[model samples]
Target: MAEKEEYVKLIGSWASPFSRRVEMALKLKGVPYDYSDEDYLVTKSPLLLQLNPIYKKVPVFVHKGKVLLESHLILEYIDQTWTRNPILPQDPYGKAMARFWAKFVDEQVTLIGFRSLVKSEEIDVAIKEAQELITYLEKEITGKMFFGGETIGFLDIVVGSMIPFCLVRGWEGMGIDMIPKEKFPELNRWIEKIKEIEIVRECIPNREKNIEHMMKIVGRIKAASKTA
Candidate 1:
């Protein structure tokens, strides 16, 4: 692509699932870029605010000075622009199916499902809700390497970004284990397979470390809320 002539930059955070998605996409597609870490809560830089005023979130990609927000959108842009190692399926239906699962997991699993932990009522609903989703996955996803077919595709990147988060917090911290070893064998198998991939392995956060990090953050926020 003509865009390679210009520098590519990514503003991301260390433990953010969203940032990991973009990082994995860029790595999979063989897109060379620089990464700048941003602190979302403490201090956000001017460049980050300017690039993503609406959300002011991390995982913003700057291509030749043009800013792109949202991890999913950035991943699609990288896949289309690079054309090196294609992430999406070629077949039309296959592509749609892959995208469906990806979006479903990204929106529900990561955003809504994970947030359920902090609140007492939300925690119960979150567990039940996650189990329902996993049940559907167990039935629908039978064989075929990934959610797509053979190679790891777009869906893999998005879901994989959440895998570590799920394992660390949802499973280890909360003691939920939505994908119990016996019940969701296929999903567990896929998680094991994903770990073998270097890019996936490297980008995922350290599970134990993240649990501690998250606890500290959550505790501080809860304490502050009580005082307020």
Candidate 2:
């Protein structure tokens, strides 16, 4: 008896780091998947709504007709299912730490960093808070070539996916350098190393175009703040 063929599909937005991380994981595992580019800012597609009625967000992973929500969860599913080019660490302790850091990146770093960029009145305080959270990452990544040690892993995918927006170009578009070379040497080095990977490079959106789109979003937020 032969095994059934699996169908994998990923619905995601071009600019979403969460979406990119899931895509990167699939690519790393060499899983073939159909991709649907969703522009939810304009309108959410019927399929997206049908698949994820609760959040209706992109980066929804569909494997053999079973739907999975949340990028981190999707990445883990892909890793466990494929069993090749492992994304998470093998050791229990290492795996736990990786999950912890990934959660930190999504919950703490991403939240404070975006607030710092858009909150003009509280920009100073927000930046300080953002930097404080980032300092923890800087220390965590010290003495390592990658978060996974020698190669990109779960934590690397989570943090690296946000590099364009949180660490480098996105901050640059807002006239700020969040990760200075002098201040964060290890992080800067890790950024360069991760960007050199073919999969990471492919997952990254075009630099100029991404910055333009982000600036437009920032403009809208600022305008809304003025009205409110």
Each model's TM-score? 0.87, 0.93
Candidate closest to the true structure, highest TM-score: 2
lDDT of 1 by residue, 78-172 (tens): 88888888898878997788778877887766555555545556577777777787676666557868765677778878777875454346456
How would you encode candidate 2's per-residue C-alpha lDDT over 90-159 as one tens digit per residue? 9999999999999998988887777777876877787788888989989999999889988889999999
Off by over 4 Å in 1: 1-4, 121-125, 166-168, 216-228
Consecutive 10-residue window with the lowest summed lDDT within model 1: 163-172
User: Worst lDDT window (10 residues) for model 2?
Assistant: 162-171
